[model samples]
Target chain A: MKIRELLTRWVGFVALGIRRTALRATHTARQRIRFSGLGVAVAIALLVMVTGLSVGLATSTTVYDDDIDYWIVPDSESPESPLVATDSPQFSSVHETNDRITAIDGVESSTPVLAQVLRVGTNESDEYVLIIGVINSPALEDVSGLNTDSLTPHDPYYGDGEYNGTWTGDAVLSEGTAELLAVTTNDSVTIAGNRSFTVTDIESQSSDVGNVPTALVQLSELQHVTGATTYDQADQFVVSTSSPAVRDDLEGIYPQSSVQSRGEMTASSTRNSDMALALAATALTVALVIGTLFVVTTSGLELVADRQQLAVLSAMGISVGSQIRLVGAQTLVLTGLGGIVGAVCGIGGIRLINAVAVRTITTEPIAVVSPWFVPYGTGVGLFVGLLSLPFLVVVTRRVTGGKLG
Target chain B: MAGSVASFDEASSSVVVSATDVTKRYTRGTEPGVLGRLLGRQSPPTVCAVDSASLEVRTEEIVGLAGPSGSGKSTLLHLLAGLERPTDGTVTFRGTDLASLSRRERTRHRLEHIGIVFQQFHLLDSLSARANVALPLVETGVGKRERRRRATDLLERVGLGDRITHRPRELSGGEQQRVAIARALITDPELVIADEPTGELDTEAGRTVLQEFERVAENRAVVLASHDRETLELCDRLLRLRDGSVVDQSPPGGSQ
Candidate 1:
C-alpha cells in the first residue's frame, strides 16, 4: 500500500480506538488513566520548575538588570566567571572611559562603577556586605533601580580627578541589609569600620543578585575612602545605548577590554556553571524516567486488560500496525492532557517557590518560569509518551498473538 | 435459501478456500533432561492441534465444523482465517496459497477478503452497535460518513435497525450476536468464518443467528464451528472432527 493510504487507515483506526478507549475508561478504567496522568503532570512540573530555577540562578548571577545593553569590563574578565568580575586585580579608568563612551552618537548614558566587599556595621557590631560605588549618572537611574535623589541631592564633582571633589556621605542599603543593620533613612552606618555614612534609602534587593547584603555609595566618596584614586580607577563601566551600532565604538575605546551584550553575559554564565547544569540534567532525566515509567506501567496494564478486544480486532482483519497506532494515539492524548496540567501547576509552583524564598532567603525570587516553558513542557511530555512505545509494541504483539479464544 | 444457493452456483466460480493435508502443532512445555538442555536439542512435548485436516468451501455454501471440546474446530477455523499458519501442507484462498504471502500480506488479504465472528460476540463495549459494525471498515480507509451509512444498512439487514445506537452491554445476547454478524458482513468479504458464534446464545437467540447466517450465506462462503446439532442443521454440509482429524462428512440434514 502507499504510505498515504496506510497513514489514512492508521489514522482512522487510531481515532476510533481513542474514542472507544476514552469512553471505556470513563466507566471501567478511570483510576488508571487518572493516576497515570497525575504522575506525568508531577514529573513535568518538577522538570519545568527545576529548569526555571537553573535559568533564574544563571541570570541572577550574571546580568543585573534588563536595562543595561552592554557592559565594558577588563579583557581578562569574563561574565561567566563572577570571581573574575569581583576579584580580578586589573582596574580601568572607568570615569574617563564613561565620559568617552557617553560622547558616542548612539550611546544613551554611561556610568562608572566600583564594586567591593567590605565590612559594614553599627556602632556595636558589623557584618560583611557588598558595596557598589556608582557615579551619579542617568544610566544608574535606568540600570540599578537606584534612587539617585537619595544618594546625592547634587551631582558629585570627581570627574576631573580633583582630590577636593565634593563628597556625599549618603548611602542606599538593600532591604535585607537595612533589616540586618536595623537602620532607616537618615541613620548613620559605618562602612569598613572607619567612615560612617547616612542611609538615605532602603530598597528591596534585585532578584538578579539573590540575597547578598548590598549597599550603594558615591563613587568619589568610595574612591577617597578606599584609596583607589592614586590612578583614578574603577572596576567596570556600564553603558546604555538605544542602538547596537555603539558596540563597535565601545570596543574601540580600550584595546585590552571586552564589551559584551546581555545575551552573551547570560550564555557565558550558564555555560560555566557545571553544578547548575548537572543538577538541571539530573532533574530532567529523573522526570523523564518517572513520567515514562508511569506511562509504560499504566499503558501496559491497559493493554493486558484489553488483550481480548485486541485479539477480536485482529481476527476481524485489523492489522498489527493499526493496533500499535491505536496505542500510540491513546498515549499521546493522555500525556498531552498531563502536559497542559503540569505547565499550569509549574507556573504556580514557581510563584510558590519564590514566595517561600522571600520569607526564608530574603530574595524576591530564586526561580522564574519563562513563558516558553509551557510549550516546552508539553513537548517533553509528548516525548516521554513516545518513549513508552517500545513497551507498548511488545505488549501488543504478545497479546494479539492468536489469543482470541 | 435453496434458490439462493442455486443462483450462487450459476454466478460464482471456483472455491473460496481449500485446505489440503493441513497440520498445526503446538509445543506444550520446556525441554527435559540435562543433555537436552546442554545441547539445546529437545523436542519437549508437542500436541498436534489440527492433524491433516483437508476441506474445501465454495461460495454460497455454509460448511459446519462439528466437534466436541478440544477437537480442534477452533484451530481449524483460525487456520482458514489466516490467523495462524499451518505447520504442514497448504491452505489456499481464491487460488492464492496462504503460505506464499508474508505476514503483512496475509493480514491485508484477511482485511480485504475475510471476516470473522466469535462466540462471545466480541463487540467493543465502548461503541454503539452501529460503530461495532463499522469497526472492520476502519482498516479499509473508508470515509466516516460512508462507513456509518453502510454499517447502518447492515445492522438493518440483520434486524437491528432500532437497536443501532445501543451499546453492546445495553443489548440482549441475540441483539449483540446480530450486531456481530453485521460487523462480519461490513466488508462484504468473500469468506466469513465463525467459531462457535452461537455458543453463548439461548435457543431462540441461536436460532435467530443461524437464520441470519443462512441468509448471508447466499453470496459468500461461511465456515462455522459448532457442536450444537440445531446450528449444524443450518449448514449446507457438515464436517465432523475427532482427535484433530476429519472423521466423517454429512450432507445437508444428514445429522438432523
Candidate 2:
C-alpha cells in the first residue's frame, strides 16, 4: 500500500510538472513554431517507416519447421539416369544413394520426393498446380511446413465421381484453390490429362504462398497422370541427419547432388533482418542529425531569451537541475505527442501502399501490425529528446547565472 | 518617566547586526560584462565597493546608511545581510563569525534570521501579494496554513489587506514596496535590510513607505540605505558615506 501511494504521488508530480511546463511554454507564444518539435516529428516518422517495413518483412517471411535438416537435389552436372532435370535435377531412386550415405555413419534417414507441375479442374473452374508424390508413411506425413490437420479424404475432390480406396486418381486441393473454385468437400476433380479424382483435403495457405491449393497425391497416381516411366525417380531427397556436424559427410556421399542445411535457410532469413537493421540505422542517423540540430538550436536560443525569468526562478530556490528537467520534460512531451501522430500516419501509409499494389494479386491487403514497431518509433523520439539534454543544461546555466537583481 | 526610559535601553541590548571593517571589492570582470575582457580587466578593476565599513544595529534602532550611488552603502548592507562575502573583514552574527560559515550556512542564516528588501521591490511576478509576502517564511519551512495566516495579518498591517491576491504588476509602486516589507518581516528576522527601497516611488508614496519601515523597525532593527533626506529625518541615526568611506553625521534632527 505504501509503495502504491508513492507511485501515485510520483505520477501526480510528473503530471503537474508537465502541465506547468506546457502552461509556461504558452507564455512564450512566439516560440510555438520551434524547429525542434518539427525535427522530432520528422525523426519519428522516418523511424516508423523504415522499422515498420523491416519488421513486417521479418514476420511475414519467417519459416518455422523442425522436420528435415536438409533437402538434397541433383546437381545440374548429374544429367543422366533418365530422370528429367526439372528445377532440381532428378535421379532414379533414393535407395541407390541411401546405402552409400548410410556408410558415412551419421545419416539418419533419407527419402525421395518426386514433384511435378500439373493442372487440376473442378466442373466450375481449373487451376495450375504443383503435385507432390506422397511416400505413404506416417513419418513422412509428420514433416512440418505441411498442414496435415485439414488433409481429409472428403475435401472438394471426394465427390462428383467415384474414387478407388488406393487413392489412385484421387487428389487434394489447398484451401486457396477451394476458395477460388467455389468447390466443397464432396466435389470431384480431374487432374493432368483428364484423370479423375476425389477431393480429399485443403491445406492452409499460410504454409507457402506459391504452393497454396497445390496437390498432394499418391506416388503411383502422380506417375500415372504425368506419364512418367518410373515411380522411383525423384526430383529431390528430404535428408534428416543425426546432428548438424554430419551435413558435410552426407553431402560427400551424393557428389552429384547439392546439399543445404537448415542453418543455411535460417541464415538467409537472418541476412534479411540485418539488411533491415542497416536501413533503419541509416534513416535514424539522418533524422537525428537533421532533427536534433533543429531542436537543440531553437531550444538554446529560447533559453537565452528567457534568461531573466529563469534567473528569477533560480533565485527563488528552484535548482539548476530542476530547470533543465523542466525544459527537457516539456520538449519530450511535445515530441512524444508528435511521434504518436507520426505512427498513425505510418500505419495509414502502409495501408495505402498495400491497397494500391496488393489488390492486383490478392483481394486481402496486408495490414502491417507488429508489436515491436511502437517502441521503435518511441525510441526514436526519445533519442531525439535525450539529445536535447546537453543543450538544456548549458543554456539553463548560462541564462540563470547569479544575476536575479 | 525618565527612569523608565533608562530601563528601555537595557531591553534594547540585543545585537541584531554587527560588522567590523568589512571590505568588498568588485572587479569589472565580476560585473558580468565583455568590456572587462576587451580592456584586459580580468578582475573588477579592484575598486572597493565597500571599504572598511563598520556599523551595528540594536534590537529596535532604525539606523540609516546615507550615501551617494557608488559610496558603498548597498554593499555594506549586503555584507550585513550575508548576501555577499567581505574581502577583508569579518561580520559576526550573535557571537558566530559569519565569514567562517559555508555558503549554505550563510543562506540558512539569511533565510532564518535576516530579511532583505531591494530597490526594485524584487517580488516574484508570478506570485500574488499574499504568496510573495509568505515566500521567505515558506523557505524557512513554515507550515502553509500558518504562513498564510501570518502573511495575511502582515499584509493587513502594511495597508494592503485588499490587495492580498493581486500580483506585483497590479499594485502601485508604493503598495508593491509595502508588500516587500511585509514579506521581509514575515520570517520575523532580527534585522531587515532595505536598499533604496523608496527610490522608485513619488514623494508622497515614498513618505508612506518610509512610515511603514518605521513601523516595522519598532520590533526588528531596520537598516536602510537611502539618499532621501526625508527618510534620514525619520531614522533614529544617520551615517553618511562618500567614496567607500563612512562620514560621521550630526545627531538626530540636526539642521545640517
Choose the strongest candidate by lDDT: 1
Best by TM-score: 1
Candidate 2 structure quality by residue, lDDT tens digits, A118-219: 677777777766566544333344322444333432222212222233444544565656676667665787777467777666655432223223556654
| lDDT of candidate model 1 versus the reference | 0.80
Q: After superposition, how far is residue B219 of candidate 2 from its true place, in Å?
A: 3.4
lDDT of 1 by residue, B1-256 (tens): 9999988775535589999999999988876678887888776788999999999999999999988899999999999988889999899998789989988788888888998888988898888898889977878888788889999999999999999888888999999999999998999999999989889999999999989998889789999999888888888889989889998888757753
True contacts kept of each: 0.62, 0.00
**Residue A271 in candidate 2, Cα distance off native in Å:** 11
In CAPRI terms, model 2 is classed as incorrect
Model 2 chain A: weakest 10-residue lDDT segment is A154-163
Tens-place lDDT per residue, model 1, A230-288, is: 76667677777899899999888776777888657655656557766776788789988
**Per-prediction TM-score, please?**
0.80, 0.56
Candidate 1 docks with a DockQ of: 0.52
